[model samples]
Target: MTSHNPHGHALASHTLPGHDHHAAERARSVADHAAAVVELLRPLREMDRIETLPLSQALGRALVQDVAAPLSLPPFANSQMDGYAVRSGDLSDGGTHLRIMPPVPAGSSPQPLEPGAAAPIMTGAMIPAGADAVVPIEKAVPDHFLDPAKTTANTPASTAGNGNGATVRLPGTAAGTFVRSVGSDIAAGERALAAGTCLGPAQLGLLAALGLAEVTVFKAVTVLLVTTGDEVVEPGQPLPPGKIYDSNGTLLEAAMKQAGLLVRRAGISTDNPAELRALLRTEGQGADLVVTTGGVSKGAYEVVRQAMADQPVDFLHVAMQPGGPQGLGTFDGVPFLGFPGNPVSCLVSFEMFLRPALTELLGAPARRLPLRARLSLGEPGGQLTSPGHKHQVRRGSLQPDGTVRLEGGESSHLMHALAGSNVLVHIPAGVTELADGNEVEVWML
Candidate 1:
């Protein structure tokens, strides 16, 4: 069965049937096909469900709406320095002495600046409406504006010079000097932050400065996770003969959680097609997407491959190492994604394919940060490749000097080595080899 999505894109329905002639068809590049799948699920993005969250709890979530500044930063003109606020026009070429008003502490409202007058203002204190410039206390003729040097020297001459009816000599300053004008940081009624921005400490701080206590953000995507294999057993259970603890349950679930998705794991499914299909149908009803690790290859006991056989899925061998077997399609009106059984392959598939597509659809952060770094082999002159394949990703450790050393051999089952590495080094197809210290693209894991 095949149909078109709401956007009219061709949504083919196929499955892995013993690698027959139809299964031999190649596909577009990984990027190309990944983008196509993302577009196909464009309508399922969680952006439509928006909720208001307090700014205190909104960090690390993407904002669903543009936030306009409610009030200008510095809401009133304020002093950026602990000094005297003055009108630039009140100062002469040599020096102009101005009568001082009462001190303006940070919390007190400052009196308006009169002609040929100045106000003692503390940092963050509102500048009198008429003041246009601020003279640092240290720069005043008596030099008393609380400079560290003046304070350490026990200088009382600074304020002592401003006795009754006394005028303080101040040098000319440019208008707006050391004065934070209204909306200097952010203007009232102007856009403070655009939508789709992931809020961090600084971003939330800006919103808080604009007096926003609550913000709106999109709902997180929910995934129905299924880990398969008869040999796969839960971690806490007693080990039976020929059974190993299922790490995919831990691995993929943690990955999905880190990607800001809601993950509901179906636990381990034995190698039974009927049981797998029933479990998928039971759990997948409420999920926006369905993901299964293992049982996606051509093995005889491949439960996911068998369960999704009748569904509209195209299982293929993508031209990539470790993560070759790929299956994805719409099943029961929900997007179903299948990944290889290997722990490393499963994680890599999420990073390379699902992360980008999901983040692009929902405007979330693409946490897979790729950096250009030098590739180093164990030996002085060495290279690595997956032969004819266009891209081979290997576990690697990025050294302090900005070179990545391959962690272990190119085996997908080496979960220990994968755990020890911090990055994935990409060796493109065209380059058959690379001498030690050759440049390559490194994805920060």
Candidate 2:
């Protein structure tokens, strides 16, 4: 059924049937589900704060504004190789000998090339004004000059003649050959990187080449992580009967970190609605988004649903597996997302929804993607899927042979299998099974 939030935005929630009795009419397509999520997050992206980060600390940050090159790349024409700098005209007739001028080291300045003269230049050294091309030292015939530091027109090896004289025979070359021209890579005042570009090593290196010490980037989206369920306990804590360690909180925190989001742990809330409501009020203040796990499913103790009853949060049963039950709303005016309690479900939800939306919204490069892998098991047929759900997430391990093998059953609560698996095997809706060697999409962890 469609409901309107406080902002008058459309909200959709579907009633899920049992696995054996799925109703396709009530299901939502994965694409549609994802679009709905992006819609909710669209406003958040525009609301992102802009900040300046030093180049040293900007790695992995997304740009908030376009960056223009302050100066042309290479700034000046320079030698592309350690060779003899000569006027292309001097060698136009074929191999001809020219007297070698002083050798130009990388940092040293050299006088312009004169008629019938050649200057020995090192790679990256400024090309003398009158020189139009460079002949690599190895490509030049005969004359060997002393090191640039010791060579000059007066040196014994720097004389004019054929053979023994400081004369090198260079073949005719085209103008600009082996010469790196200014602004070849990036012109001055041209855009170097677009807004929303994620700054990685290559991007940062590009900025460094342009002498940019800092960059303007959107502030990393801050995620306030709150996990629900009283049965969940922190890792290493005493696990009393019927209580499992809270894995969703830890899992999401790490996942958010990898996605470049700043994560804050608000710890786990019990199945108490009043307690969860209080926690949301306190923790949701400054966060760009708030995420909670569990307490939105059909269970009687759905604390998140009860706590957010008066709020804009809509508890949804999205047509996807391992994470069908979902939640989206505004908590204390901050966007909030509630994921299933299952470890695998929580992670899969983030991958299918939050990651993709954030990538577009933040202009960050997509960090995770599903890989096509053949099912390792030579099943008699394809895998089974929820009839109504358009997507299913299964625990899997990517095998060395380039296929992903299912490691656990389809049950969402199976954490052991989830822990053992290195990837999430995805099965699109309506597929009954796949014969051996059939390719399937898997999200590598």
Candidate 3:
């Protein structure tokens, strides 16, 4: 009862007996594989691979080092009101009429105020040297600032002996009132942002305020993606009998890109071990990692296992359903990962293994949040039984009422069911069955 895919490669359906026979050989724990991946990519986090990117392009990137404020915010002492800048000593007893100097608008610096003179100042204007406080325009007698256009070019004298027509009556004001002192917001030379801070809108805004046009961050990992299996063909092609459209390539590529990895798809490879090996050699030269889907199972036509046999790849099974078959190792000095061909399995493998490792090492593609939710009545709790030896990751929808409903059955080929899921329910290997209203751990996608 041997079945073949369109290209004459042995299909898994025809080799189920062989898969079961070899499932136990070279098996690795999920935890061990995750740690291995993290170790493999640890070198990519080296300081030599850091990139200096412009503030505009640094969003979502983690800072490589601490950034100090180049200058104090509001760099200079300035008035906070469009009113009169006066020496507090002048208005000691009560309200008094004082000679008004030329108006100082925003972005302008003014001369020192005389002992009995007030300078008409606009918001954000620099305070005169002798001024200690400001009176807002509304609180002043005239309730307005002097018009700059009306002031004559002849420099008015600050001496009380000279005649100055413009005068303003201001109430006694306290020292340091309504003034933005130097370093009021942030002091110069202080740490503005700490290392490993993820650059978001507010962070980039702060960097811009710090007068930094660029920042240093970790470089993105470049992945070479290759999908395998003779039964698979790209979309938009006329499908022959027993052939299926390729979804693993698009699925894994999108997932990797969304995780902030620079992905380069090397196209699909067939069941020929020599062809796959040659393709990896040609395309995996400059990549930080290489990922291939399918051909890692125990079937006779397991091309990835066959091609990577002499390359140090360890093809093994993880204690998990849907995505139990896994492969990891190096191909010509480049880190390689091989996942199963099923679309759901491929995606789940990425979330379970690669994403967490990337988040831990490079600090990109923020980690998925783990939460606990009760099973809803709609969920088939009675039938949700998993083997006691393997951890099960089930697709589920988190309801608005804080409950989770299973999206599909345990089969890994339920692509549409996975599409409708918003969370991944985790069933530990020790727990064999779940009941309605039981609290379960889930990862928010």
Candidate 4:
């Protein structure tokens, strides 16, 4: 069940039942094969340990420890508005008048109030020692000072009696009015942010309110990418005869970036055995994982198989359209993943296999784009008629009302089809036909 690559490397083999022995065995089922690959890679998975990071750098990072408030929010009974701070006992239904004291601005120490007097206080100012309530400025009358010219002309008998009797009146307010008490929003030692939670804007604000300047979070992983093929050319280059632009490399790198992996390198290797082997050895040095697209099949120019002849390479033909070929093994103590060369196939393989496993390893939630909808039209040739394998993926999209529309021709080489699609319709194998209106499971892109 083993095959040799050009570099004398023995690729891991699987036996197909008496069919084209040249072609790799189709997987029994796409889901089964995907699960098996995840199991195989479980041991090599690693997540960075937690580190305390400043608040400025903690955005979008996963929290590693629970955060508790060290002190009560507000920390003291304070004024909520610019007004008069007075003792509650001085608040009478008929309005109590008290001599006005000096103004109390915010950030200054509270001045002790006379037993029945009031003090003018600004918003956020601390309440005086004897004050229990605040009455807004609108509720008080301003005192007029003496003016010699006006007073001299209006010096009447009644004015003289009431001249020195001028006093300010206060409105009736209940105790504790306009006061933000200590621990009103949060108490000391209260749990503010739970462990393992992903920090978002609101959470970050709450942490800041709790006086946290730093937090501990897990580090992101790093990945190395390799795409192999003799006919593949970099983008931005003219497509010469007998060669196609490399799409899988960019596609895989973007996908890995979305999964929180730092893509260290994305280089291409031609179908040369010696060059591929040397590249693998050189790139495997600090890479946690090495991913390759194309040249793992039984074709003669399959450079990935030819180059790593001495290393372990599992040639898997999963039961899935567009993404049936795969290679999984280790190269120089680093995990290796190989996918088919076709652009659509590479993306499909990533969505179906790598994403879920990496999510589990990184303690991230299993996030997938999936939708349920009725088929827009009848796909008569849609089902897989194979006897052994059971699962296929088809490019699809959702209509405005949730109907599923199949897009593009079912060719693996068609990158346009993959690009235009927003979903992957998963149809189980052995189902000969699905009627036009049948409900189906769709994975969103």
User: Which candidate wins on TM-score?
Assistant: 2
TM-score of candidate 2 against the unseen true structure: 0.86
Clashes of each: 3, 4, 0, 6
Tens digit of per-residue lDDT, candidate 2, span 1-445: 1211222111235433433234345656678778878888777656437778899998888888888999998898999998899999888556887877788889888888888889989899999989999998887875455454543445453334644235677888899999999998889999999988989999999999999999888778888899988888889889999998888887889888988889999998988999998987887778888899887876777888999989898887777776777898788777889888778778889988998888888866455667898887746565443333356677789999898878767766677887898888777776645666788888888
Per-residue lDDT tens digits of candidate 1, residues 106-182? 98887788887788889999888789989988888667743333322233454433444545789888999998888
**Which candidate tops lDDT?**
3
Residue pairs in candidate 3 whose N, alpha carbon or C atoms collide under 3 angstroms: none
The lDDT-based order of candidates, best leading, equals 3, 2, 1, 4
Worst 10 residues of 4 by lDDT: 1-10
User: Model 1: how far is 418 from its true place, Å?
Assistant: 1.9
The all-Cα superposition gives candidate 2 an RMSD in Å to the true structure of 6.1
Prediction RMSDs, each to the true structure: 7.3, 6.1, 7.0, 8.8
Q: Which runs of model 1 end up more than 4 angstroms from their true locations?
A: 1-28, 46-48, 92-97, 140-163, 166-169
Q: 1-445, model 3: which lDDT tens digit per residue?
A: 1111222112233455434534434457678878987887788888888999999888778788899999998898899888889999899557877888777778877888888889888889998999989988898866866565554434244212235456777888899999999899899999998887777899899999879999999888899999998888899999999999999888899888878889998888988999999998898888999999988787888899899988988887787766888888899888889988888888989999999888787777778999999987464645456655567788999999899998887777788999999999998766777788899999998
What is the full ranking by TM-score, best candidate first?
2, 1, 3, 4
User: How would you encode candidate 4's per-residue C-alpha lDDT over 312-347 as one tens digit per residue?
Assistant: 878777766667778888887677888888888888
